[model samples]
Target: MSGPGTAAALWSALGSLPLAHLVPTGLGPWGDGMARLMLQPLDLLLLVALVLLAVQNGRSWSDRLALVLPLSWLVGGLGGLLVGRELHLALLCAALVTAVGVLAALEPALRLGKRFLRGGTAALSLLFGLVAGSSLAGHGGALQALLGEAVAIAVVTALLLMALDPPHPRWLALGLRLIGSWIAASGLLMLGWLSRQPL
Candidate 1:
């Protein structure tokens, strides 16, 4: 039972378990990376929250988000790949997501200036991207998966920017805030779960 065959079997069994954040489809690493956006959707939620926050403020510089967010993310992710390990920062990440959600939900009241919003967006994106990259580092085709995820993020961000441009109608504005609250609630649930599970 303790032979090499048994060890190999144990390793295979461990690999089969869904412990990591990355979900693999049969469509290779790139596809897995792209699918990771939906399968593991914190990235998407953050992107949405950021977009909502940006559009609500109606700053001319908001246009830069389409470029700024993804580039910072890619750079952070590359740094993560170089580190080559996962960070056990579930609680911190959950808290950050919750805070961002709150910020998006309370955008009108907050009225953060252009400089703060721009800087905050880049910093948050970079941190999240680093976490994502760290998660993928231990997997096969990590670089490809990271690239695929980055591409997906860029496309989604661009599309969101296009759809949710400034001067939103009343209903659309309320809907964005509502979605932000939901994301915040989801983050809270995540925090509660992490508190109990400690991972």
Candidate 2:
């Protein structure tokens, strides 16, 4: 199955497509709205693909966390969609959570300052919570901000998660590598598509 982190990234990327419509300039030839719709399902597909990769990588406790992280990510994104929170705020929360979990699980391997990591996370979480809460008091810009944040965080998180050498089944590792390769390829494809259409 796909890890939760990867699934979240896929959904966030798919969600980003809709945001393109909100842009005043639109997407040029791709601006009429069809391109956004066309690219939407690719997000879900990517999520599924990631899960498959995770399964192929291996079955372990850490791998399960990898799976759950994506789910947490999905919950956070869905929260923004349902409750109207800024996308960036959601992403900050998600990243914070994922970072904490990763740090905690890999503590044996990581030699960095545990205090700094925990404190920094707590501070960022609190700050983001306040921003999201305050923004909620005003208007509907939450989705826009949150979705934008999602795009950036999800993309970055995907890379980060892929970078780690989480112990797992041999097949699973192979699967993860394959997934990583695909994620890289997908990034290139997206860049090419975005650049060709004009800003």
Candidate 3:
């Protein structure tokens, strides 16, 4: 890799969960801002990829497990934005892990009869509920902060669900692409906003 490619690779790695989770704790103010912006694109990209993977692998338990990867990212990203650390949003992470494990454990049911997938469905539902609950509770009584976090989380989560569950496959894919593109654009806007913020 060279030039922008190298820079992009390094940034992407830095923004991954292990490193990104540590940034705010380890660095000063500027590092925190850089970490947030650097990770946004990765979340957006994974959102797009997971949507496509779910559609391609449709109705399979493996597809459901693939779905958890994006769910985890969405939870972690919004959780980080809202609460600023993985520890504050540990519930969300736990829910995601449970959902993924449930999906894996139910794979045989999906292949052989589909009864086992019920447990996975319940796990996912519970995860969703936990994520919603934590998000609402995270803002500590400020209306503006509460609304902003709720809207961001809902938009990202809804976009993922819609992408994975479009009634018409053709229109679904196209719609998800547009939504994912919009998310990428929004992330860019956030970067600009962060840059211009008073320090």
Candidate 4:
């Protein structure tokens, strides 16, 4: 075909791509953005570390700390929704993940008071939630998007809690500690990447 005809055909094919395929399935633009933000590798890692930390304190699932963790996440999500600021959440979350992971790895050896650690965990949870929620504020239907993301976070956290219940065996406990180390390493790597970005 002539150059003009070939270019026209290519443009037509590109334009013909289905909107559903262009966007996330079931969730329109807002939902798509919310899902993308929540399901990021770093975000998922943070959630996993948070759940593990919540259960790692050698406390029962019914412990107040364990129970309050999810609530703190929700509150943070709400705070993020209200504040709607997209400033530096990735950096904040990375730092929190690093802190939480280090704490988890050291908890078995360190004699850090349980109350202090729990308080730190709760604060991190709120901040992480805020970061996650704030990321979704710029999308359409902000309220609905925030709620959807919060519910997803809650469900994942609940499942993790259930799976880790009944207390971990020695082998599993060791594995969790190792995972904590890995999370801390990942967070550190992320921090390094963030540092190189232009301000």
Candidate 2 lDDT score at position 101: 34
lDDT-wise, the better of 1 and 3 is 1
- The order by descending TM-score is 1, 4, 2, 3
Cα deviation of 146, candidate 4, in Å: 1.3
Tell me which of candidates 1 and 4 scores higher on lDDT.
Answer: 1
Ten consecutive residues with minimal summed lDDT in candidate 4? Answer: 14-23
What's the residue-level lDDT of 98 in candidate 3? 33
lDDT of 4: 0.67
User: What's the true lDDT of residue 142 in model 1?
Assistant: 74
In candidate 4, residue 199 scores what lDDT? Answer: 27
lDDT of 4 by residue, 49-79 (tens): 8677667765553255445665787688678
lDDT per residue for candidate 2 within 62-141, as digits (tens), equals 24434343434434444434554444333333333334333333343444353443344334423443443333322333
Q: The CA-based lDDT of model 2 is what? A: 0.40
Model 4 clashes, total count: 0
TM-score of each: 0.85, 0.31, 0.30, 0.74
User: What are the per-model C-alpha RMSD values against the true structure?
Assistant: 6.8, 14.1, 17.2, 10.0
Alpha-carbon runs more than 4 Å astray in model 4: 1-23, 28-38, 61-67
lDDT of each: 0.82, 0.40, 0.40, 0.67
lDDT of predicted model 3 = 0.40
